[model samples]
Target: MRREQVLVFDADDTLWENNVVFERVIAQFLGWLDHPALGLPERRAVLDEIQAANAVTHGYGSGMLIRSFADCATRLRGRPVTAAETAEIAALAAVLIDHQVELVPGAADTLARLGVRHRLLLLTKGDAEEQRRKIDASGLAPYFQALEIVPEKDDAAYRRLITAYGLDPAESWMIGNSPKSDILPARRAGMNAVFIPHAHTWVLEHGEVDASDPGVLHLGALTELVDHF
Candidate 1:
């Protein structure tokens, strides 16, 4: 007998253009930097270092990114940052948070099709309020049976979600672009995972997926998911 399957989806890069927004914001922030001695690479390195440290306390979101920009600017300048500079960074955060939510090519169509045959859940990691804002704006909420905005996605998180939802791991499928967050953790939690690689995946989310992992499936695009279901 075929088991009833629950399909879980990741919100950010998997369904929409998320990381590119951050990339653009970082570029603009770098352009505003007063320190010309620091090249783009050096500035980015500083930003990444600060963001990583902030992630532990701040988690993830535009707010964390905004704080990172402020911290990076101060560190690079070797002096207190000006109010004008801080405001500029704040404006970048505003742009990021207010940016229109555009779905990845064929994301809506694929979700529509899959939603009809399977119980679909949106499982994403980020600041709850910010994630909710994106979900509300994306117009993809109706397709999901539930929306889970978590602080992090790990094996423990996946296990908790599976248990809370009363989902059979053997009959569940987790789909997303991140190997670290979506693929590895879900697979570790005993669910099947489908990895749809994204061109602009965040650096922190990068991880290797073992080809030999029986629970893992790799696809080239969101549209290809229709063929699987």
Candidate 2:
């Protein structure tokens, strides 16, 4: 049997619905933005491109997403956006603020089962308030021994978590869907990692993973953790 160890989890796509909600809101915005010349795919490309540039400066969350929508519409229309259009775009995100947190299938049960033997820590990065709000809503917060919300989950962030938690890098594992934020960085910090790819993972979090990586394990779903750990 494996030894009891620290398990760090990414909260957004890993635990509950996040980017999917944004995608739904964006779809609604796009429907409203039906352009005379551009097709749906072309319109989506414009928004995606604008978000790639704006995400670095604006950071993340619904507010930044709304900004990207406005910027996209402005660029598409070739004119400064009116207050009405901005308000309509803002309403899309406003509805997003109230979207209920939907946990991944068996997430709560898996956390409960694992918590009995291992320490579980939630290590999600995003707007602090937004992250916390989701945490509060998920009802899975009780499973975590502690939670750390940050702007980004980089290698340094992983290293810092180790220092703060007094975790043994070899004994610890990071669990989540995103390879960029969860798997690779944890491996770099000398911890083992489990990659469970999500279908609708944010474009920014995509990263290639090698199947032969020494300590990285890939799983089909969250419930499968029960058998492994």
Candidate 3:
């Protein structure tokens, strides 16, 4: 019989086009600002700063992003934001929240194939409701034996998952795009990790990774995983 390995997958960027949607929405928000003094780069910097601040208090999701956009617009305009402007911002949030969850190439095929031989689990971090909505819409939900949406992805979180599922560190593997959240934490938890880098990774998610780590494996694409395992 094939070994019963516990395979954990990250939902965002790892399995679908997540950060790309956020980037597009940021562009739309900047267009709405239309500040002569603030160029695209400056506006992006301002938004990132505000978003980071809001993330600490409000956590992560479209709701936090919308609030940050409103705050940034108000700061740039040097005046109280009008009700109409707020309405437009709300519309933008709607578009972002309702955007279709597009799967990464080969994600579905790989998950389907792996499901037959391994215990598949989706480990994602974000707003609970938003993450659930995206997972429900992705159409890839059936393949996972469980779905975990957390406030943060850290070593402690991975340890809890390992304990909760009664998973053996030697037989468990975590696969994702973010080194800080997915790869490093899994390795720290004594589980193997597969790093599949994404082009549009969020700046906050970037971190220094030691390629020499024996427990970490790097793949150029999601399809490559099928051949590796």
Candidate 4:
């Protein structure tokens, strides 16, 4: 049980819910897409297909979702949609995108407790503006010394953080929700990982692993983080 130095945390599902809002927006889009001529199931199928394809290219974001909807609308309408129509679609997106930061239960308390001793850093991946907006609105920004908003959480991300912070991987811990993004990669980098599961995690964030490793740990809630160390 070597003493820990730096503790990095993921921002999205780790601190708050992200994909749940996406799911709500997708549902709203599906309802709007359905008409007398277009069946809901058929429209949903097309959306799913487009989203699957878009995941390969855009990864994840409101922009990608809106673009996919615009593309689908164009194919169905047989005519170019007006700017007004695009605005309507994007307006539906705004409801979720404009949402205030709703922290996961106990996130603030846990972070406050942990901030007392460890060097805390936020390591997350998402659109720069949106991620920053959420961080700012969450009122939790002050807890972290810095943030590393990356495109992907991989071995490279871990190496970069270690180098940037001048930290020993063995003495640093990565606390996050996604096993794919946080646990496996951190373990591979020889850092301890603490996984706090969120109910509505994105599918792409899933990855295979044995959580029994000394370097890997899982918790049910964010507050459990304080006890792990």
Candidate 5:
């Protein structure tokens, strides 16, 4: 393998505990849903229904989580919930949103090390506003040469980044946690792919694969790539 010039990194779970926060908040709401007055089965039923119905639309976001909980509360109570109760539920999520940002273990040191030799860029997907907020709070922003927040990551996004940077995919590597969003598409674009597993990954991000993908590489964590370099 030739030395790569660009080291594109994914922002969310790759660098920090992202989806876990959402999962934790949702768990709290679920615990509330299991109140004796609500019944365990009924609570699960409501949550399952909401997720099934909203799976394609809202996906995962603060707004979707908030609305799903609000809808579930109304359904369980058989009437609209009071503003105070709604506020309380939303407050749990609010705290998560406002909480101090933290990087995954070794994230900063690894990035700082890699940034010295590679042209580092942060490529992430999701709500642009929220992503920016996380980036700002993370203090990982300065290490990257540039940052991008897109709705979808595909060949077009890859091409745009390459074009913008005047880079050759042959000499650039996409390093991220998601198989769907980072590895597979990047390989298809003729870019080398480095997969660094995270503790949490979304259901849709999983992809079927075999060992023949020469451009694809896997590491235990982001910091592990220092050895590869």
Candidate 6:
């Protein structure tokens, strides 16, 4: 019998249009902030800096993002953010949390086809509730054998999943848009990776993809999976 292979997928920009929604919210936040001396580019730079710093301390998700926005606004104003202003920011930020999850085209059909032949797992990093909410809303959760939501994805995290699922690294592949979180870490864990780049992937998730790596597979879209595997 052929050895059973496992395919681990990333949820964000891989399965759905995640970062674009965040971009929309960021645009709204920047417009609302409207710093006296800063243009849109300058304001975005400041917010990105704050988000990078706050991500480690406060973690990811819409809530932490809005918190960073508030902090950025406070810094821009050079004064304590008033409660009224905070409330307004929160109101404007609600769409970030409640926005409908947009699944990538053919994602569900691709996953369904793959799931029939190989075990499928979802490996997404974010706030638990926020990630789960998206998974549920996408109607793609049923395609995965197990859905994993973690604070981060790294070599260690991939190894943990390997051990937990009794997966053989040689027969496993990480599929996603993130070279940083998905491809690199899975390669480090002795597993293969499938890279599907997304145009609007978050800046923080950007990293170098070594196309020379023999274990790496590059594909254009989810529908292309059937021909290769």
Model 1 lDDT, residue 219, Cα: 93
Predicted candidate 3 versus true structure: per-residue lDDT over 1-229, tens digit per residue: 6676889999999998899998888888898789887788999899899988888888888889899998998888888789998999999878778799999998899999989888999999999999999999889999999999999899999999999999999989999999988998899899999999999998778887798988888999988977766
Candidate 4 lDDT over residue span 1-229, tens digit each: 4364788988888898888898788788877775567787788767767766886687667887888888777767767768998998999899667887778888888888888877899988767887888888989989999977886788988988899989888888898878788988998888988877778877667787685677777788888888776
Which pairs in model 3 have colliding backbones? none
- Which regions of candidate 4 deviate over 4 angstroms? 35-49, 52-59, 74-84
Residue 14 shift from truth in candidate 4, angstroms: 1.2
lDDT of 3: 0.90
Candidates' C-alpha lDDT: 0.90, 0.89, 0.90, 0.82, 0.80, 0.90
lDDT of 2 by residue, 1-229 (tens): 6689999999888898788888888888889998999988899889988888887888788878888998998899998889999888888789778889999999899999999999999998878898899999999999999999987789999999999999999999999999889998899899999999999998878998879998998999999999899
Q: Model 1 residue 222 lDDT?
A: 88
Q: Give per-candidate clash totals.
A: 0, 0, 0, 0, 0, 0
- Model 3 quality (TM-score): 0.94
Question: By TM-score, how accurate is candidate 5?
Answer: 0.82
lDDT tens readout by residue for model 1, 1-229: 2335799999999988899999999898988885768888888888999999999899999999999999998899887779988887898778887899989999899999888788999999989999999998999999999999999999999999998999999889999999989999899889999999998998888899999988888899989987877
lDDT of 2 at 189: 90
- Writing each residue's lDDT as its tens digit, candidate 6 over 16-81 gives 888898898899889999877899999999999999899888778898898998899999999989
Off by over 4 Å in 5: 1-4, 35-60, 71-85
Per-candidate TM-score against the hidden true structure: 0.95, 0.95, 0.94, 0.85, 0.82, 0.96
